[model samples]
Every structure is written in structure tokens, then in C-alpha cells.
Target chain A: MTPISFPDPDFIARQTAKMLLEVKAVHFRSDEPYKLTSGLVSPVYIDCRRLISYPRLRAALMDFATATILRQVGFESLDAVAGGETAGIPFAAWIAERMGLPMQYVRKKPKGFGRDAQIEGVLSEGDRVLLVEDLTTDGGSKVKFAEALRTAGANVTDAIVIFFYDIFPDTREALAKHDLRLHYLATWRDVLAAAREGNHFPPETLAAVEEFLNDPLAWSGANGGVDRISV
Target chain B: MFDQLLECLNEQGAGVRAYDACARMARARVSEEPDNAAAYLLLAYVAQRFVESYDDQPLSVEAASEEFQQFTDIVKMLDKAEADASADARIAALNVVAAKLNTAPKTGD
Candidate 1:
């Protein structure tokens, strides 16, 4: 792999956030919060999958992803790349080709009669697999995919995503319990920073988003959304 | 022996060494009992993985078609095993079938 210069994580985060904003992938609605599957109601929402539609933007982000992984985890550390089912598949495909490693995808559920049923693609017993996803809300899906990969005999210690909803306070602790380190290009905080700098949203809307980010469940409760994230 | 393989297979970070162990054990079971549908299913699962590993390759049209045919063959083997395999094995085989269907080549591809 060609050597890549490491940019400050903050810079990458802000740039990624700006790109998301540019693509109109981030939505902020404080008055009527969007209900998350986890049950938390929020005034902020983002769809990282939109990045895939813009080839140039996606390529730049992929470069940032490869650089981030190489800098944080080392270039030679990974044996293969695995995307988390649907959304993660394209990103993983690009990254795996760039890194010249085999690629696989993890299904949400098992497909066949063996331990490796949940995994699609050839993963060796000691293959150091890097799990990729589009975005993480509360880090729940990562844990599930990582467990499935582990069940299939792949060593999964690291997972990366394009966006992370850093609103939840316990996401890191939850993933750490599974021995899966989480990496991402940007988060709600970074997006908020970009919005503030760019004046992307009305001040009130931005303030509402910040309030929701600071205490999501509380905001959810006040806004007629679930007070606590279920399970 | 199957239980041990399952444990290793399910264990986090077991890696290629663990998968190899499982494959070997599965093959051994098939050798001992050629009629064992479960063993055949396991082998099919392994074969599916092997086929998927080639997805990143820049295959020529002919190569891609060949690979797709191989994948279809594996899915067929798993379906054949499903009739005689245990309930767990049947579920597993079906899952593989579903995954294969999702990626199966379109007509004329």
C-alpha cells in the first residue's frame, strides 16, 4: 500500500461532516424529533449511505478511512476486510481492493448449517478481520456482526464506520466489552461543529440538535419520544 | 469433536487456525460417514466461503461466469443436504442458500 500522511482526527471529522452536509445527508428537526429504532428520539439524523452515491466524495472518504486505519492500527495488521451486511458492503469492497486484501460480508443472521453460516466469503481461522459499516447509532449492530465473525473463526478486534452518532454515552464501553475497537471518520459533535462554522442550520435548530446530542434520552422524553433506549 | 469445533468456531478472534480445525473435523466426519448430511452441509458452507473470497478479484467475463456457476453448484449441494440434515443443519443450509440467492448473477451476466 502507498504510504499516506496522517491528518488530525479532528480535521478528518470536520471534513467528513462537511461532506455529509454538502450531500444533504444530515437532517436536523428539533420540533418533531425522529424516532430511532433504539427508541431514543432525536432532533438530529444522518444517513451516511448517501455518501456512496457521490463517487468523488466516497473515494476521498475511503482514502481517509484507509489512512486512518493504517495510522491507528498499522497497515500490516489486517488480514481481510468484512462489511456488515448491506450498507457496509460497498465501502468494504473499495477498502479491501485498495488494501489488496480479501473481502467478506457478515449477514444480520446466519444463512447455513455451520458455524460460519453468518459470514459470506473465505475467512481463515486466524484472519485478522476489519469490520466495516456505514454508520453506528449505539454500536449495537457492530457487536452483533463482530460476534458473528468471531463465531465463524475470524479474529475481529477492530470495526470502522463512516459516521457515528456519538450521542450515546455508553457506546464505547459497550463495544469495549466485546473487545471490538470502534473507529469512525466523524460524529454528531463534528457535524455540529461544521454546522456551527458553516451556519448551515438556523441557530435555534442547531441549538436543539446540540441539546438532543447532549442528552438524547432526555430530549427524547421531553419531545414525546422514548425516555430510555430499549436493550 | 463437533462440540469442540463449534466452540472454536464461536469463540471470538479464533482466526484461520480455528476455521481450519473446524474444516478438518468436518471433513473427518464426512469421511467416517459418507451419508452424513450434516457433514456435507458443513463442507458446503466452507466451499461457499472459498467462492466468496474471490469476489474482490478483477475477473474476466468468463471467469466471473465460472465463479457464479461454482456458487450455484454449492447452493445446490446445500439444498440436497437439507432433506436429510438435522433441523439445525437445515436452517444453516437455508441461510447459505438465501445468501447465495442474494448474490446470484442476473440472467445474461
Candidate 2:
């Protein structure tokens, strides 16, 4: 196998964003805002899962993912790669294969009964596990998955995703509080940059998306979505 | 378990190894229970991949229509299995598969 090349983070971010746009994995709507599971209505939505359908794009992204993790976290620091159930599973699988590490997946909820019920595959005590996901908005789900892994005796100090909603002010702090060092390839800003470069949408639509990204809660409130994020 | 299968598919691309893994899993499920909808649904997913692998090629109108009809038939079978499956895991998996099928990109879209 050829050695993986580690490109500059900015280049990776821009390329990933471009791939996302090219594949139509992104949606920009200002007229009819989309509501998130967190009740934050916004003009931008992304379906990273769509990347799976585009074979070439998916392969490139996974290569970038492997390089990003190795460079940012270290090649040998991780013992196993565990994906947060559902969307994260495929990405984790590819990453684990690239890194040649054991693979596992953390469920959203526990299965039958036992300390390791919430985890599938083999997880040993003190294993340094890297949690993989498609994206993170508020880092809430990552924390939950990390907590589960920690409970099962795995050391989950770092988590990675293809995209990150960097608009959330406290997202980094939140992940830090859970002892998870978050690594990602791109963010909304990168997507916006890609959009601007490609002229993918009308200026007005892009402006609306930027406004929502700047202050999601306020925008959500003004747009008939939940005003405050309930803890 | 399904996660592993998806990982296998993704890592190997649409190669024989990936298809064989999916086929084996589907076969195992069918052998365990003759009317397993979830297994058939998974097979249907694999069939979808076959169509996707030919995305760059231009096909005859008749050929395209035949593939579309086969896809719809698999989906119909999955729907029936979703209604009939008794296990919670199988039902949940089928629901996820159904949801994916609904959101999947249309041919040529």
C-alpha cells in the first residue's frame, strides 16, 4: 500500500467542503428553514451520509480522515477505532482499516446487560479508543458516546468527525469537559467558503445561511424554531 | 454486526468480497428463518449497489426500466418483511433500511 500523504489541514478542509458541495450533500434554504433535532432552525443542512454513495469522494475523504487522525492524534496513540452507532460506523470502519486497528461501535443505548453492553466488538480495559462520527453540532452526542465508552473501561480522550458545526460557541469547551479532544476535517465556514467560490446558491440564500450560522439560537427564535437550547 | 458489513462494503468498494459478505449474511439469515425480511432487505441494498456501480455508463431505456422495477420489487418485499418480522433488532434494522431507501438518491438524479 502507498504511504498516506498528509496535506495541510486547510487544504483538506477546502477539498472536503468542495466534495460535499459537488455531491449535493449540502442544502441551503433560507425561505423554508430546516429544524434540527436540537430544535435549532437554520438555513443550512448537511447530509454527510450522502458521501457513502459517491465511491471516489468517499475514498478520498477516508484517506484524508486517516491522515488527519494520524497527524493530529498520532499513529500509535490509539488502540482501537469505535464509531458512534449508525452514521459513524462506516467511517470508523474505513479509518480502522487504514490504521490497521481493531474496530468497534458504540451504541446510542445499551443492549442486553453488562458493563460492555453498550459497545459492540471487543473493547479491553484501558484501551485508548478513538470515537468517529460523521459530524458534530453541539458535541452533545459525542459526549454521550464518550461517556459510554469510558464506562466500559476504554480510554476515549479523542473523537473525530468529517464535519464540525464550529458555529456553536461552547462546543469545544463542552467536549473538553468530557475529556474528548475533537478533530474534524471541515466546518460550516469551509462549506460557506466553498459555496462562495462555486457560486452554488443565490447571494441572498448564502447570506441567510451565514446569519443562521452566526447566531443559531436567535435565528431559530426569529424563524419560529426553539429560541433557547434546553439542557 | 451490520456495522461490520457496511465497513466491509465501504473498505472494499463494490468488489466481490463486499458482495460475498453481504450475500453470506443474507443467506445465513434466510437459512435461520425462511421468511426473514431483514435479510432480503440487505440483499436488496446490495442490488442497489450493483446499479450504482454502473452510474457512469449510459444504459438502454429498457435496461434502466428493468433495474428500476427490480429495485421497487425488493423494496416491496422489505416492506412486507418489516410488517412480518418479530424480533426487535430485525424490525429496527428494517426500519433504518426502509428510511435509507426512502432517502436514497433517485437514478440519474
Candidate 3:
């Protein structure tokens, strides 16, 4: 039998960023500016949901996700892989298959009642569960999912996302406050760098994106968007 | 529950297929079965499609806003339905889209 091998973190990050661009999952419209449901106006938007359509790219990313989990947290660290609500279910299922672990999903709200109302699969008490999400910004949803897991008596210390906005300075601190170690494959920084290398967009657009990435909140505020993010 | 919805949908028959009729049927379903998100989604779809029926018309700015707001009231329930992680919500969303297309008056290409 041959041992499984994985790409280094930098290589994985670059590949993940490049794939996101290839699939057109990342959008930058600084001039038009999109209004998020959160009421913030932003120059950037990402739809990780689109990844599900591209089987090859999605498979590669899931492999990278499995590698990241194993390398960072060790092979024996997780008893189950749980997805966060809607978008996270498929990603968690794929990763759970790769890791050969039990799979579960945390609902946004409890269905009826009971200790595990928010949980779908059979999660043993004290099982170490890693919550998976397609992407996260300020870690608000992660906190809620982690809290739900704790309420159901699962041991959750780490959460992984396919993409992390990373522009928010308080995201890590917020997750840590709840004792969840945030792990992810790529971020907007990697996507910007990949865009630069590929000359994907015109120089002006890339430059504008870089400026926003450097100090996102200030740029957003200057552009008539929210300057500060809560949670 | 959807069997009953399908029968009510069929009773509408061909012709004008009024949005008012769709709303009335959906409301009746809600009264009979309170937790019918699909009924609301289907009704909302009918309203959106009703708006689409006026696409190429010379609707004034004021008229267009009024037409849109008429259906917008039914849209808030959509988030409550979409946010649900259960298979029931997923299936409901899918079924309503298909059902809406079947019943909605074809407006454009």
C-alpha cells in the first residue's frame, strides 16, 4: 500500500486561489459596489456555492481540505465532521468521506426540541467534531454552530472553512473567544495575489482590489459602507 | 399536503390564471395546514411571475414600483424557509419552483 501525500500549504493556497478564479466564483466590482444582506457595501463578493458545479476542482479542494485537517490537527484528533447548515453540508460530506469519519450537520435552528435538536447525525457525547463551512467573514455563524454543538454535548475546538475573508482583524479573536481554532485553505489575499500573477483583470481593477484588501474597513467606510463589523 | 396543492393548482385551469386566484388557494392551504412554507413560496413565485408578465409593457416608474411591492410582502417568509436546513425545506423550495413554472403564464423567451 502507498502512503497518501499532500501539497504544501503555500502550494495548496495558490492552487485553491487559482481554482476559485478559474471558476469565476470570486467577483470584484469596486465601481458598481454590491450591497450585502448585512447592509454593507463592498467591492468584493464570493460564491463558494458555485464550486459544487465543478466536480474536478471541488474534488481537488476537498483533498486539500482533508490534508490541511490531518496536518494541522493530527489524524486522530477528530471523531466526526459536521457541516454548518446549508452551504456547508456537501463540503463536510466530501471531507468526511476523505477522512473516513462520521458526518453530521448543525441546523441554523432547532427543529423541534431535545438535546440534539440542531444536530442531524448521531454525535456521541464528548466526540471531537470539526465544523465545516463553505466560507466565513466575521465568524458569527461559526460561533452559533459551535454553541449548538456544545449544547448538544459535542467537543468542538476547531472549525474549518473553504475560504476565509481574512480582511476582518477581529475574526480570529472572535473565534478564539469561543475556543474554536479557525482553519481554512485560502483567503482574499491569496485570491488577489493569484489575480495579479495571472493578469486576470486589468491593472486598474487589480490595483483597486489590492487597495481594498490592504485596509478593507477603511476602504469600505470611505466608499459609504460600514467601517466596523460586529461579531 | 402537496397532493392537495396540486389538485387546487389544477382547478385553476387555462386562461388568465389570475395571481389573485393563486393567492386565495395558497391562503386556503395555509389555513388548513399552518406550517406550509411551500404554499407561500409557490404563491410568491406566482406573484413574481405575474410581475414578469408585464416585462415588455410600457409600465411607468410609479406603476412598476407599485406592482413590485404587491408581491414583496410575501417575500419575507422566503428567508425563513430558505434558512431552514431540513430536507423538507430543500424539497419544498425545489417543488415550488417546478410547480410555479408549470402554472405561471409564460411571458418571455
Candidate 2 lDDT over A97-212, as tens digits, reads 88889999998768999888899999999999999999987787788889999999999999999999898787898788778899999999999999999999998889988998
The digit string of per-residue lDDT tens for model 3 on B4-27 reads 333332233211222334555666
| Candidate 3 runs further than 4 Å off | A1-3, B1-109
* TM-score (chain B) of candidate 3: 0.36
Instruction: DockQ winner between 1 and 3, please give it.
Output: 3
Q: What class would a CAPRI assessor give candidate 1's docking?
A: incorrect
Judged by lDDT, which candidate is best? 2
DockQ of each: 0.02, 0.02, 0.03
Identify the leading candidate in terms of TM-score.
Answer: 3
TM-score of each: 0.67, 0.67, 0.68
**Per-residue lDDT of model 1, residues A1-231, tens digit only:** 533677788889989999999999988877655545454556777777788899999988988899888988888999999999878999999999888899999997689789999988999997999999999887877998999999989999999999988877788988998998999999989999999999999999998888888888788678654565421
Model 3 residue B65 lDDT score: 36
Ranking by TM-score: 3, 2, 1
Root-mean-square deviation of each candidate, in angstroms? 13.3, 12.9, 12.4
Model 3 has an lDDT value of 0.74
* Clashing residue pairs for model 2: none
Clashes of each: 14, 0, 0
RMSD of 2: 12.9
lDDT of 2 by residue, B59-98 (tens): 3323433443544455455555556555775576566666
